[model samples]
Target chain A: MKKKWLIGVLLMVLVMSVSGCKKDDQVVLNVYNWGDYIDESIFDTFEEETGIKVNYETYATNEEMYTKIKNGGSNYDIAIPSDYMIEKMIKEDMLEPLNMDSIPNFANIDDQFKDLAFDPQNKYSIPYFWGTVGIIYNTDLIEEEIDSWDALWNPKYAGMFTMVDSQRDSIMVALKKLGYSMNTKSVAELEEAKALLIEQKPLVLAYVGDNVKDMLISGEAAMAVVWSGEASTVIQEYDNFKYALPKEGSNKWFDNIVIPKGSEHVAEAHQFIDFLCRGDIGFLNADYVGYATCNTETMELLDPALMGTTYAYPDKALLENFEVFLDPGDFISEYDRVWTEIKAN
Target chain B: MLKKLSSGPYWLWSFIFIVVPIMLIIAFSFSVPGEAFKFSLDNYKRFMEPVYLKVLARSVKIAVEATLICLAVGYPMAMILARMHLKYRTIAVMLLVVPMWMNFLLRTYAWMTILNKNGILNHILSFFGLPQMTFLYSEGAVLLGMVYNFLPFMVLPIYTVLTKMDNSLIEAAEDLGANRRTVFRKVTFPLSLPGVLSGVSMVFMPAVSTFVISDLLYGGQYMLVGNLIQQQFLVVNDWHFGSAISMLLMVMILITMSIMNRLGQDGVEQGGGNIW
Candidate 1:
């Protein structure tokens, strides 16, 4: 009689657990974005405004995020990846086209951030944050006004500055210095860029990633090739550091949000993206992440002190020198080989 | 029939987790990217290039150096611990192991702070009117990290062997007119050979394949074979080449292990299966 009672309880528990595996009625939107790229409180606010649950995830790099999404087991509803990756994903049909009717707040995005080369019609992605790559230097270390990429290669600054560790960013510096497009496909142009980088490798104190900001602030490296957003953060904190866009030009980047092709909660994903695009929410995110926002409404709400700052928001003429990174497609192998060879050497 | 039924789960687990993944890796290694089901030696051919060969050579060299350093430092530590009183031995062993309880990356990051240009080490140097050094982002820093992390692996196995060694054999050698140095040289060192061999392999394997230590310490200025394979899969999205590199690394490790096993066999026979 006791054995029968225990068996009955076990059967009941198993049934309950099995039923628990079934999907709940509440919608959950899975969002994958770069690490520390959002104002996390916005998620709670979003959940309050809409009943959809926000399941947030983060990745450290575009390549890492792309590899995960490309492998396809992760059924993320929305992802925020940079321009070139969005272009690649769209080409591969990994992205679902945005329904303009669903995303009404996208109209608040600035005109300059729209119809970018990656998304010519702005169909698949909405601009999340945009910034350019530039040099952030310690003014206290060098007296002369720094304006060009050649300062990185100067013998005087050897072992005093860091180059970005990223393949595209590092190669872009060399290509721009050589007066070639960052997205150059010609083997000769790439070879020249490779040679330039190899020559400059010894002078570089280190090849660093996002930690370049900390290194610069700590005065480990007197100068670093960094994204404008990171530079702006350091410039705001320190009196000695200054940001400069070199005369030879540099790459501009945009991180944009898009719904992945296999999203189960398409409507909730649209609602979340629209929520993020709202002016006050955009302002909160931009303020927290310290990146330039695409929403013009958010721009007006920004701190007046940061307006027209070289690192934060440069003038239109200075912006003309920046080129957006385009998807190199299969030609990226050349870049990988070149980068590996450089590091190996 | 009962035993077979009991072992069924083990067989299933191995088949699903170990056998299947290896088969997949082998299949991927033989194939070319963008061309499905087409087998090619192109990935292996690419790895043979001088740039990649140098990376492999550098990785082996660093691993060897780290292993040697561990052996040098750990052998003494093991001896000291083996000779300690029971009450103190436990405390000493725990001291060696306590830092390992912390996350490996966190420990490595702590080293970065100590070795940075304006870090604790530099502050001490400046305080004493000494020149500050750029100790981080160099090959030396990476080596230091490998040795610091893997030293316990080298010590623990050797310590177990030394502690388990028969005291009668050493006493017998002493009675046969052998001095302290001669007794240790003959009995202690030879019996400890199996432990030493296992320790070398344990330290060498992880040191060679560790990407995180070199990534954080050298700041990606230095490339190793592990980093190359990581770049192929994660950055370049070329699983074929990555798998090929992984297969090569596994083969290299197997070859080293077999060589060590051959050396350890004679010691194991003499030491009575305390190889650890």
Candidate 2:
């Protein structure tokens, strides 16, 4: 009786395994992006319109996405990584150059965003969203206007503010406050930044990430160093919270979509990129994600209230203070060591 | 022949899942990043730096503290559970295990909400006119998280050992004019040492290697060895150094386990024979 039962189970397993392998003629395009980055409704719309199945995934950081793609087992066709990471991937030859003819919507991108440092010829990546890093503070907590990064180190506000947990962002705050370039490669400059951070460590309530938003909303902190996108969402929801672009300047960043080398569905990946670039689609994503859109048509479609706000869309003069993050290449280890030392201390 | 054939799948599973991955990690630990098949000890040398060693020492310190706390609290609870009425024993054990069925990360996240500055604990404290304290983002909070999560591992093994203990032995000591305390000191505790050893290893192993607990509870300020390794591999893209740290952690754990095993054997010898 046991033998017969075992045979029956084995046959059932064989049948189930075979059925699992069965696939329809539809092509599946695996699109990996930041967690909570896009409108979920767009997936259904894209699938319905194109008949290309969307296998969507999310990663929390650019490094995580880069590691997974570089490791080479995952079959992800498209990934959205930041400017520095895109540059690193291109230098490593891990990205496939885009065929611009396949994506006519490339013309929709603003000329200012195009031919930038990361991909000068716009070969490997397409601009998705761009924003700056700044401080989001509650007006009721601090009486004075916060126009400088030095406000972070004020002993009066000790234990009332948080810094970004990221290595580059936190180091940039220290460097900018000291009047050094945010992308300084000098060992002495980095050591000085490290010393500043270590000195400020006692005053910091915490070094936090995405949960900074929740902390601020609950009044756990008076201020936090945050990406402009996160600040925009919090500012729109809360009446008292305001974002400041410190006069000492800060990091401007862009997250762009790129196809990893050896993607099985390149054609479908280009199609998805084109679909994402449509004005209506870009508007939906930009509005949903609370990040500045790169598409000119999407800019025209944005809410007038948001456009009028300098923090969300800074004017030309204000833009000059922001510098795009450059890939440090081999010098990133110095950053790693400095950050480790600060955290260890 | 049939028995050997039946065990074939087990050996194959171990080879594919366990043995190969370990070999890969060992290989990576000894190699240089960005250079193919070039062997070097630079990764190990880098880990010998003071900053990384301090991280290692902190991880060990916290793990030891958490283990001791678990033992202090869990031992008496286990003894009580073992001595309880059979009817109550089931309910008590169920209560201990029910919370563990929920996700580990979820339980840690729940602590964040309770310990936040404006969270439930502070609210209660303020309601009673007590000053609000910062409970989250401290070494204490991280230690509390570790003890809370791993307490069950400490309790269950000791409970099993206590319950399975020979009642006749205790009765004989009583009949021979030995008091309860004398009997427990001379007999019961020695026999339960094996369970204690296993429990210590179980709790200490995970506590030492945990990154998430420190990351969430201490707000990235507290750097543990686990977090150091995670940062190297994920953020720094330096797998060689990460692998070296992981290998060192593995060696430390192995040494600890072997020491515990030796102690357990000595306990068994003192108790007159192996009880398990």
Instruction: Please report, as a residue range, the 10-residue window in candidate 1 chain A with the lowest summed lDDT.
Output: A19-28
Instruction: Give the Cα lDDT of each candidate.
Output: 0.91, 0.91
How many residue pairs clash in each candidate at the backbone level? 0, 0
Taking all chains together, each candidate's TM-score versus the true structure is 0.96, 0.96
User: For model 1, how does the per-residue alpha-carbon lDDT over A1-345 read when each residue is reduced to its tens digit?
Assistant: 775898799999999998876646888889999888999999899888898888999998899999998888989999999999999999999999889999999999998899998998899999999988988899999878888999999999999999988899999999999989998999899889989999998899998886888888788889999988898888888989889989899988999999999999888899999999999999999999998999999999999888888788887678666788989998999999999989998
Query: Candidate 2, after superposition: displacement of residue A202 in Å?
Result: 0.2
The segments of candidate 2 whose C-alpha lies over 4 angstroms from its true place after superposition are A1-23, B270-276
Q: List residue ranges in candidate 1 displaced over 4 A.
A: A1-18, B270-276
lDDT by residue (B99-165, candidate 1, tens digit) is 9999998999999999999999999999999999989999999999999999999999899989999
lDDT of 1 at B182: 95
Report the Cα lDDT for residue B25, model 2: 90
Positional deviation of A23 in candidate 1, in angstroms? 5.3
